[model samples]
Target: MTDLIACTRAEFARLRRWPAFWIILGTWIVLNLVFAYLFNYLAYATGSSMRMSNGQPRAILLQQMLPAAVPEVFTQGMAMFGGALMLVLGALVTGSGYGWGTWKTVFTQGPSRARVAGGTVLALAVVVVALVLTAFVVDTGVAAIIGTVQHQSLALPGAGRSLLGILTGAVILGMWTLAGAVIGVLARGPALAVGLGLVWVLVVENLLRGVASIFAPIRAITDHLPGTAAGSLAGAMRTISGEPTPGVLDILSRPASFVVLAVYIVVFAVAMMWLLHRRDMA
Candidate 1:
């Protein structure tokens, strides 16, 4: 346990200095700022809210920019767009080590492969949690500014609801991060791992879902895919906010979506460990 904790701290320290990590993390934050708040705020100011308000009243555009909407609105990007970026962060976490021979050096220094994998995962989880918390803070701040400037109420989400929303964001982010870690382990380099991960997340999944609509067997399989599960998970809290986002769907029951997402998170974590164990790090 001590070794694992040490490794986790070490991994965290290393990741903090990584430029790619900051780039990807910053991108997610910027995306949240733009799509989640900026775009809607623009629509509200320009009287284009009717067209961009998901078929709701123009007032909803203004309302969504207020503090009470932060919980769900802040998470709208994590479904697919944010998840893809997190995957790249994950790929860099593990795959870049192999590319630079860092893994080989670490293996020679006597830590067990399992310990290193665990450390990587633990550190990644911490990062994921931080991302969610950071988004909540940023979103709430922006929402508050919007509310105050517009003279809208400054009421916030309930403490319990806000906590739950943060947890939901962490879970979604964790699953995709680990999925990227697994690919990083399998590919053994950041470039290929990133390319493959993006291809799967961006191109392949969409194509498969489109095909699945017409083919029954494909539909059955697509229903359980990780992207589908993530989308459903993102949609799980949609009833609370009324914000519509791309890649957020209701294909699975809320319970089923959570279950599937949990399964994928576990599977990817274990797969990452097993892959690191079996492969020659040297």
Candidate 2:
């Protein structure tokens, strides 16, 4: 445990100086800002309305546009773009150690292979959580400003519910990051790990999900895929804004999705540990 903590601290210190980490984080913030503004602008122009349960007409444009609509915005952004970016970030962070021969040096320095791997994962988790919270803060600030300017209500989802949704999104992204780290360790390079991870996320997952729609049998299997399960987890957040929920499919219930995501994380972590222990890192 002492060695693991030391390694984790070292990883954190290294990441603090890593430009890619900041670049990705900055990009995420900027993208969220742009989208928040765009969505608000659309709401202002086209305008939207819906009937409340009490049969009263409600203006949904502000609800959909403002940061007060965080559940909707957070889940949509994370599930769609943020998740993919995290996978790449994870791959790069882990694969860089091997690319630069740092892994070899670290292994030779006397730490157990498991401790080294655990340290990397711990660092990645910390970074991921910080990034996720930063995103939430930035988006919320942007939305609040917009709402103030437009004289719109800044009503938000229940605190407990919103926090739970954020937590779920974080877990999903964390899993993606770990999976990418595993690929990095196995591939021993960022390029292949990132390329393969992107293909799996963008092409393979989409293709399988689409096919599942036409064929029932395939759907059953594809629904359990990591990406699919992640989407389900994110979708569990209720969007009171009445906007259409993002994502192509959501077959699993929230509890079931959580279980599947947990399975993926455990499997990836175990695979990474196994590879680290058996592979000749020298």
Candidate 3:
């Protein structure tokens, strides 16, 4: 336990100097500011109540752009747009370690390969949590400030739930990044790792979905695929179709999606260890 903790700390120190974290964090702040302004501007244009539920004036303005519920709107927006960007950020988090070529050094530092893998995951988890927390704080602050300027209240039902969803979604988004890092460790190159991660997420997943439609057996299992399971875990909102893909039971009752994600993490960690044991390092 002490060894793991020490490794975790060492990994954290290494990741702190990464440029990827800063770049992603900066983009997150900028996006939050821009979107908050747009949301407030739309509220002003619509001349909506902008009033608190208690009939008092509000300090934060929550605008309704889509016909769906507020929580649903936020969910879809986060999953489709912000979430995608975050996925890339996740990859960058793990990939940056590869770029620095430090995982090898980590393995050589008396800790076993497994310890190094655990340290990498521990560090990445901390980074993901911090990144997501920062995004939510910056976004909420920007919206609140703008709404206060406009004399609009910013409270909404399920706001807290939506925030939690974003945080979990960010973690789920990191799965691909983690996968790529594993691949990067095996391949000893960043290009293949990034390309494979993106292709799997953007192309292969979609292709799998399309193929599953015509093949009954594939359809049976494809729903549990990484992309599908990530979407399920994320609980992203869809409007054109108000249908929830995973359903309440699937998310709350069944643990398959989470299990799959866990498997991915474990598999990659083991694979990285295997690579470390076999491969030559400088």
Best model per lDDT:
1
Query: For candidate 3, what's the RMSD?
Result: 6.9
lDDT of each: 0.87, 0.76, 0.55
Give the runs in model 1 whose Cα sits over 4 Å from its true position: 49-56, 240-243
What TM-score does structure 2 among the candidates reach? Answer: 0.89
Q: Is candidate 1 or candidate 2 better by TM-score?
A: 1
Residue-level lDDT of model 3, residues 1-282, one tens digit each, is: 778888889867766776766776577556644443454455455655433221212222334322113334333333233444555654554555556766556666668766766776777667666666665555555556655665656674376666555545454645654665566675566566666666666677778877987887877677776666666655633322322322211322125656777777677656765775666765
On residues 170-270, what C-alpha lDDT tens digit does candidate 1 reach at each position? 98899999999999989999999999999999889889999999888779889999899888877877754465688888899878988998999999999
In model 2, what lDDT does residue 100 have? 96
Which segments of candidate 2 are over 4 A away from where they belong? 42-59, 240-248
RMSD of each: 1.7, 4.2, 6.9
Task: Kindly indicate the candidate among 1 and 2 with the higher lDDT.
Answer: 1
Better of 2 and 3 by TM-score: 2
TM-score of each: 0.95, 0.89, 0.69
Writing each residue's lDDT as its tens digit, candidate 2 over 1-282 gives: 899999899989988899998887788777766654554455455554322222212355556567656755666666656777888888898888889998889888869889988888888888877877877777777778778888877776578766876788678888888888888988899999999998898788888887888888877799899888887777666555344334523578889988998898888888887888789975
